[model samples]
Target chain A: MMETDWLLGFAGGLMIGGAAALYLLVNGRIMGASGILGGLLDGSDRAHWPERLSFLAGLIGVPLLLAPLWAPETHLTGNPAVIVAGGLLTGIGTRLANGCTSGHGVCGISRLAPRGIAATVFYILAGGVTVVLFRHVWGLI
Target chain B: MQRNLFALLAGGLFGAGLLVSGMVDTSKVQGWLDVFGAWDPTLAFVMGGAILPMAMAWAVARRRGVSLLGTPIPARAEPRLDHALILGSVMFGAGWGLAGLCPGPALAVLGFGGWGGGLFLLAMGLGMVAAPALRRRLDRLPA
Candidate 1:
């Protein structure tokens, strides 16, 4: 089961990388999910709104179309406070940092960019520590 | 027109990848982060797999200088380390640990994630809207 899961993950990663490649090669954009969405929201990338909207349409629409077949599950927490807090933090953090997992973790590190590498390390470390604290010590989540 | 079409295709591919890779599963994400517990290392494969093609893409991009659509490729980002990167990352990490959902998956899961997903998305949008003001305040503080 674990092996199967790992294989699936790898395959999916390949698809993600392929998508990034396509976006960069064809569109000349970095394919950062947060930046793509945040730009629209903050009015920073209004000039490229059509492209961003086109991208988001597929991002949301494909999954919506596939949901019946895939039955994707988030298994998110039931706690409203936790959910809200998590959402807010993720939003603010990603925007402030100007990237997220897709941007910094995948694209940034792949290109050997220092900022991407540093951001990935810090976030992963912080995530580990948070898990230890919240899940282990606090048992809050 | 070609740019929009390709962008849509890329987005579809990305969304599919998130679902297939089990990235939409909050438990899988939190479990991977749970290093001291029954940690799931599958995400490592995903990360490694993703980096492979992107690395090649970067190499090709360096030589080409422009996309196939004739748009200038974005320049490499500055290497400077600053307070915003570190601080925002820590906050993002904490939020990720708390909910096991990041930006991409958060949006991707909206179709089937039910009310919880909707609420999270709403809050996330609100936070994004408010971030600029907060960022201005943070910039004022001595680094």
Candidate 2:
């Protein structure tokens, strides 16, 4: 009854965890997603530039690289305007919170930071609300 | 030991992985999984790319190697499957499925100047800052 999407979730978690681990292994940092983005905002991230550049490169480049063999026309279905709006809001959230789910949920919580744990909870609740507004209330989904 | 700093380095690599893996580009991501159009499976391959480095790192850490940042590598911990984790995951899934942007990929997108990345990053930040106060209220309830 409570079958988990273990495979997908694990892979997702693995990516996050692996990145954290790898970051720790190489740079000796926690890989907080928000912090990385923060540095990008102020242009103060010397230690993570190459890594971030490579990571960002990999994010889009990887998919593009695999396009020849995989889905080459990968794009979104929603209104482009909606997506831009969403991305903008999330950026603002990251700045105000000083972290994202990856920072608090994946990395901070993993290290047993009480604040991270708590923040992670709230993050999910907000997501749930968003879905309800967009999907259930607005019938967008 | 500057545990915080070590975490910083690890984060950078994690970010790199997210980038190279195309976890940030929602359009490409939606394109990859889009059923109506060109259903791309590049996400699969990008995920595959992580194997080597992760394996190498795991082995080295397992053998008691110190990270380049001088922190003592610890054993990998299994993620706890609890209510909190589950709840957080569901939220992540909801946002990802709806916007096709996770925190890692979203940030990566910003770096690469992907379309809509700015908006996604903004909401993500807002959600984070509000988490603490929201959590405080949740704590008042009986578990």
Candidate 3:
């Protein structure tokens, strides 16, 4: 099961990279999920609303359509406070930095972009530290 | 019309990949982050696999200069590292550790993540709305 998990992850990752490649080659845009959604929410990229909306329609719509086939689960925490806090921080942080895992982690690192590499390092380090503190030490999560 | 169509196709593929990659699974994500505990190295494979084709795409992009669709390709981001990048990443990481859901997986899981997911999305949206104000305040501070 563990072996399969990694294999599946790799295959799926290839698909993700392929999607990003297609987006860049054909659409001429970075496939940054947060930036796409953020622009729509903040009305900053109004000129490209159609492109953003179309992308989101697929992002949300495909998963819903495929739910019957796979039934994807998040296993998110039941604590509303934790969930809300997590969401707010993710939202604010991604916006302030102008990127997230998809934007900085995948796209940026692939191109060896300095900013992307730096952001990935910090976030992963911070995430590791937070997990250690919250889960290991405090048992809060 | 073609641009929107392709965008939909790309988005659909990306969402499906997230589902297949187990990125939508909070436990897997948290497990990967939990380096102190029983760590899961699955995410590293995912990241590695994702980067391969993307690197190739960047190379192609460099040569082509414009997308096949004729739009100009975006230039590489400035290499300058700023405080916002560092600070925002730290906060994002903390949130990721807390909930195990980043932006892409957060939305991808909405189909079945129930009210908890909905609440998270709502709060995330509100945060995005308020981020600009916070950024302005941060900018006012000395570097």
Candidate 4:
């Protein structure tokens, strides 16, 4: 597992950083995931369909290419209500931050954006607090 | 030369890859991290799943001396060890350990359709919204 940890982190980091890098390489826009997902909602891209389509396609399609053929299928950790709420909340969070972990943690940090660095720190801090709240404070998990 | 579309596409692929590899699960991540205690190593696959694409991009970008977006990207050496980096990693670990999710996996886990992911997302977003304030605070602290 230790061997795989570095490998997996590298891969996740690569895929994320690489994607952002590629986008920067090809597009002038920051490959901030929130911005891309937001474009879908803001109806801003009504005039530019190809850009949106390609972006959406790349996000959905790349994982299919990278997932291991025999990797074990994992199940959700909790009930349905937890997953749905989690998604909506995350969506809002990603939007507010102007990017998700990939955008901020991976791409933003790599770029040395002070905001990105700060954002990533808050994210991790929040995450830690959340976990403690749920598991220890609330005794929910 | 910057390829906005390409970047979006690359990010999408990256996100999907995260889901595909099961990197989004908190238990999976913690379990992997706990190798020092019990010796489970499934997380390695998740780490690998992410690196390949980055390497490819680096290789191409270096060889071509141009980003796929058709722009020249600035290169900086790896950042030096600093308080922010150290503090950030510890925070990230704590968050992942407690919430059972990080940003990548936390967001990706949305596909599962449950409250854990949803609440996690909410708090995660809240954290994001609070980032500016946090930054202000962190900045005021001594370096």
Candidate 5:
């Protein structure tokens, strides 16, 4: 169950890349989820809410519409505290860093931007350490 | 209208890609992170697949000041490797390891990830709302 199919993953990643590319060419925006949603929530980019909303509507709404067809498995943690802690960290951290996997990992790395590359490396390394600490040492999760 | 349509299309495609790629699965994400245990390398391919076309897009973007639709290409943020960037990334990473959910997959799985997913989204939204003030406070602290 833990094993992932590389072909599907690659194909799907291609779609994600295509979407980012399309977003860049057409809307002239980086397709970063945290940035897009954060801008709307924090009122930093209120003027462009319409475009953001349209984009999000498709992002969330389409997955829901297709939920029956794909029914993707999401192995979320059962602990309420873990869930809350995870959410808060993700929210605050992404905003503070000014990007997430999409902005820094995909878009930033593609452009060879220093910030994106550095952020990507930092987050992934941090994530690995966290996993070791929590899952291996602490066994909290 | 056209731009909005494109945005919609792009978003839909992005979400679909996440779903198809098995990224919406928390176990898959966690599995990739579990190097000490059984590690899954599918994520590497996903990142690679995404970077290829985006690299091309960036190549094109380098030549033009404006998008094909005539809007200015949004400038990249400052490249400075500041404390905030490092601190935030570390925190985000910790959270990611704990939950196996990031903002994108968290949203993508809302429909299927059930009540837990909903709870995570709500909490994350609150955190995002609180972040500006947090950053301001952090900035005021003696360096």
Candidate 6:
């Protein structure tokens, strides 16, 4: 089961990378979810709204369709406070930093860009520490 | 029309990839992050897998300079180790650790994550909507 999960993960990653590559090679866009959504919201890049909207429509819409057939068992915390706090933090932080996992982790790192690499390292480390603090030290979350 | 179609295709593929990779599974994400607990290292494989093809694509892109559609590839960003990057990343990381959902997976899982996921998505939108002003304020701070 674990091995199957790993294989599926790797295959999925390839598809993600391929999608990003297609976005870049075909449309000349970065396939960053936060960047795409944030740009639309903040009015930073309105000129590209049509393409962005189209892209986002697929992002949100396709999953809705495929999930029922190939869905994995998943669960989010039921706590409203945690949900809200996590959402706000993710939104604000990604926008402020100008990237997220997709932007930095997959796209940026692939090109060996320094900012992408640095951001990935920073966020992963911070995330690891936070897990330690919340789950081990403070017992929060 | 072609540009929009490509965008849609790319987005659909990305979303499907995310769903297939187990990235949309909150438990898998949190479990991967739980280094001190029964840690799951599957996320690393996902990252590694995603990076390989993208790296190859980038190599090709560097030589070509422009996309096949004649659009200019985005230039590499100038590296900046400033406050916003660190502080914001720390905050984002903490939130990710807390909830095990980043921007991509958070949205991808919305169809299945129930009301909690919906609320998270809503709050995330609000936070993103509020970011430009917040960023402007943060910019005025001392370095």
* DockQ measured for candidate 5: 0.83
Q: Write the per-residue lDDT of candidate 3 for residues B46-93, one digit (tens) a residue.
A: 999899999999999999999999999999888977878888989888
Question: Per-residue lDDT of B63-92 in model 1, one digit per residue for the tens?
Answer: 999999999988988898778888888888
lDDT of 2 by residue, B31-123 (tens): 433444555555544433444345455556656667776666654334433343344444554455467676676655554444455566666
Clashes of each: 0, 53, 0, 61, 0, 0
Q: Write the per-residue lDDT of candidate 2 for residues A44-136, one digit (tens) a residue.
A: 566656555444444444434444453322144346655644554455444334456566666555555565566566655565566556655
Model 1 local distance difference test score = 0.90
Candidate 6 residue-wise lDDT, B68-99, digit = tens: 88999999987767777777787778788888
User: Each model's TM-score?
Assistant: 0.98, 0.55, 0.98, 0.60, 0.96, 0.96
Clashing pairs in 5: none
Q: Any idea what lDDT model 5 has?
A: 0.89
- For model 4, the DockQ equals 0.23
lDDT of 4 by residue, A1-141 (tens): 556555555555555656565665565345655556555564544654566556655654454444454242334456444444444445445554455565565555554566566666665556555555655566654
Report how far off residue B110 is in candidate 4 (Å).
Answer: 7.9
Error of 5 at A117 (Å): 0.6
Residue A122, candidate 1: how far off, in angstroms? 1.0
CAPRI grade of model 6: medium
Better of 3 and 6 by lDDT: 3
**Highest-scoring model, lDDT:** 1
lDDT of 5 by residue, B1-143 (tens): 88889999998999999998888887878878888977888889899999999999988987897898998887877778887788889889888888999998888877777999999999889989999998887777665
Q: Rate the local accuracy (lDDT) of all candidates.
A: 0.90, 0.52, 0.89, 0.53, 0.89, 0.86
lDDT of 4 by residue, B1-143 (tens): 12445545665766665654456655665454443335345554443443345445545655776654455654533444344444444554455554455555554545452565556656655545544444455556777
> Where does the lowest 10-residue lDDT sum fall in candidate 1 chain A?
A55-64
When summed lDDT is taken over every stretch of 10 residues in candidate 6 chain B, the lowest stretch is: B78-87
